[model samples]
Target: MNARVEALIEQARGMTSEERVAALDALQELVAPPDQAWGEAWARESEERLDAYLRGDIEGEDFDVVMERMRQEFLVK
Candidate 1:
């Protein structure tokens, strides 16, 4: 195994369960994509929604309401 990976495993082995969990969480967040994690998905969905509105595929929609719903649904609050 890689020396660094082995060292990391050894360190983790000494941590309490909670500390190990926190460490793994930090590592996952650190290894996430460079740009905002959901930025691309948000932008793509937004573009699709806008296009649908412009094309009259969606009617009488309250966009801000939907945005609020999305925020709540995504637990951004």
Candidate 2:
């Protein structure tokens, strides 16, 4: 890690368990990618599926069919 992050970690290490947990949680969340990014990615994928359907490369229900098949074939009971 870089010097600033190392310093912050050292400061957190000197705190009580609750304080350390709070500081670490704050730092982790600040560095974490947003859930919206995944949502947008899935939206793009859904658009691609719709396009493929329109182009006649696949059927209209292809997305749902693939999902149902995966659920039946791979998902555990």
Candidate 3:
């Protein structure tokens, strides 16, 4: 294992059980992707958008429309 990871393990070993749990919780929050609220909001939006698309409530552009739009927006030259 890497020295940094070994050092973190050694630090955790010295903590009490409660302290270890707190540390683990803090680590989990830090390691979690994009904070819970933002992720939930994004998921909700995606599900709504997908539902709309599936029901034909929302119209989607074709692949050629997408490619042209992307080229116009992103291509430098």
Top candidate on lDDT is: 3
- Which regions of candidate 3 are displaced past 4 Å? 1-33
lDDT of 2 at 2: 100
TM-score for each model: 0.42, 0.37, 0.49
Q: Give Cα distance to truth, residue 13, candidate 2, Å.
A: 1.7
The weakest ten consecutive residues by lDDT in model 2 span 25-34
Which is better, 1 or 2, measured by lDDT? 1
RMSD (CA, angstroms), candidate 3 = 10.9
Taking all chains together, the TM-score of candidate 1 against the true structure is: 0.42
For 1-77, candidate 2 gives per-residue lDDT tens digits of: 99998998788778999998887778777999458989899999999999998899996557888899999999999
State which candidate has the highest TM-score: 3
- Clashing residue pair totals per candidate (backbone < 3 A): 0, 0, 0
**In the order shown, what is each candidate's alpha-carbon RMSD?**
10.1, 10.2, 10.9
Give the alpha-carbon lDDT of every model: 0.89, 0.87, 0.93
Please write out the lDDT profile of model 3 over residues 45-73, one tens digit for every residue: 99999999999999998999999999999
